[model samples]
Target: MVLKYCLLLFTTLQFIQARKVVDLTHTYDKDVPKYPLGWLGLENFTYFKMDTLAAQFIDEMWIAFKKIEYYEHQGTHIDAPIHFGSGRQTLEEIPPERLIGPGVVIDIRNKVTNNSDYAVTVQDILDHEDEYERIPPNAIVSLNSGWAQKYPNANLIFGTENTSDPTTFHFPGWSVEACEMLLQERQVSVLGVDTPSTDPAQPPIYPCHIYLQTNNVPLLEYIANLDSIPPRGTTIVLGAPKVRGGTGGPTRIFALIDDDQEQEITSNSASRNFMSAIFAFMYLNVFRFC
Candidate 1:
């Protein structure tokens, strides 16, 4: 009986651990792509720097620490509503509920293969909805342009060797119409992209940024590994820093995927129930032996 209980508990633990977590964030460092400050006349300016502050023995133990500095929006980061809007939620002010939701990825890699400035259109959203079910309310809708392959490469990612020139850069992003539909119709909680910005590299005006931010929807940019998760089933969790008054900051995003479709065991309630059943069985077995 004891062996049987141990085996059952081990099986239950394995089932609970079967869910896979896919990281959707890029590693932050000086090498990560950043907006060019040359347009603002700050040529050759470094936005990120890390230096070893301490590397010595402390209380018979070796200790080391590094001092790091970077722009709030650098690397895989969240752009809080205040990034573009005048009086919107700051980084720390964003509600925790808004940072987590179902994930939906709209792939536009084919369209973006040749045209660097391609924008995800409203029709794309409609087509995605037609294929998958209607996007759930508070979904984190992400645009997958296959741009994450060019990560840490300033020239290839931006479509220009002159990284300092914004006008010369090119990339794919979300269109205003698509963003509007997601905001107004589907009531999405967050917008995400695998590119550096939510807007195309060379837009006349940052329409998506302005409109979405004004409406108080946070944006996730420079996201990585969109190819790893499914379009609609996974749940997205954004690990954004609670920086007071910050416009934006680096974020660690993850997608939790249920590999076993038949079992449908990824839901929190179901997992709790399954664990409870295992515990109940063990308790009943112990009482019988007692």
Candidate 2:
């Protein structure tokens, strides 16, 4: 009886340990969409790739090598506080522990579909909290505007007829009040969005960027597949290049769902423990009665 109980417990724990990971990053290539104005408000990104397989095919091994280059801020990337200006933490300065946390997806797809320049307001955050508990401390809040489906077309993604003037573009972003509430009041670790930036494209002043940058809160931009993440109860893991003294760089972000959340392993720990107790009781009762 004891041996059987032990095996059952082990199996139950192993089953519960299985987790579901969802890729929330967009692939970067020559055709990847860019932030129209680019880093310095100049031309778009420059990505180059060279395959040297034929050139180095002398030996029987036939080794192949590829060289690639692109801007750190381009594609799905994180914007370090230093990107704004001096006296801030660089990409490397951010602690590795802050890169991962509970994920919260505040969906604004309805508002965005109606108004392209709609900004996520403080009331929206409050409404979300009222519906689904409060945003936990140090959680990573992601703004899902359903913009990931509009990729490959730079014009449509940025909502601009021309790329010369960035001010003409339109997209949903976090308002300054919302940023302050999340940063100062709620104390969230990271702000991620499906849009190209954290602030509205036509804002006279990028208050959202200033609020986050000054507070040392990392900003994730151009994130993809946010629709896959639940409003809560998901863990996010971020992987990015550690560039020394760098302002920002591309990042690979994903979310993890536990067995209970994914409904993969229905047998919980408590259930298994109760079963073990019942088995032991039955075994003892049978022997005593016999």
Instruction: Please report the candidate that would top TM-score against the real structure.
Output: 1
Residue pairs clashing, model 1: none
Best model per lDDT: 1
* TM-scores of all candidate predictions against the true structure: 0.85, 0.81
Clashing pairs in 2: none
Taking all chains together, the TM-score of candidate 1 against the true structure is: 0.85
Query: Candidate 1, residues 166-237: lDDT per residue as tens digits?
Result: 888899998999999999999999999999889998763589999999999999999999987778788899
Query: Clash number for every model?
Result: 0, 0
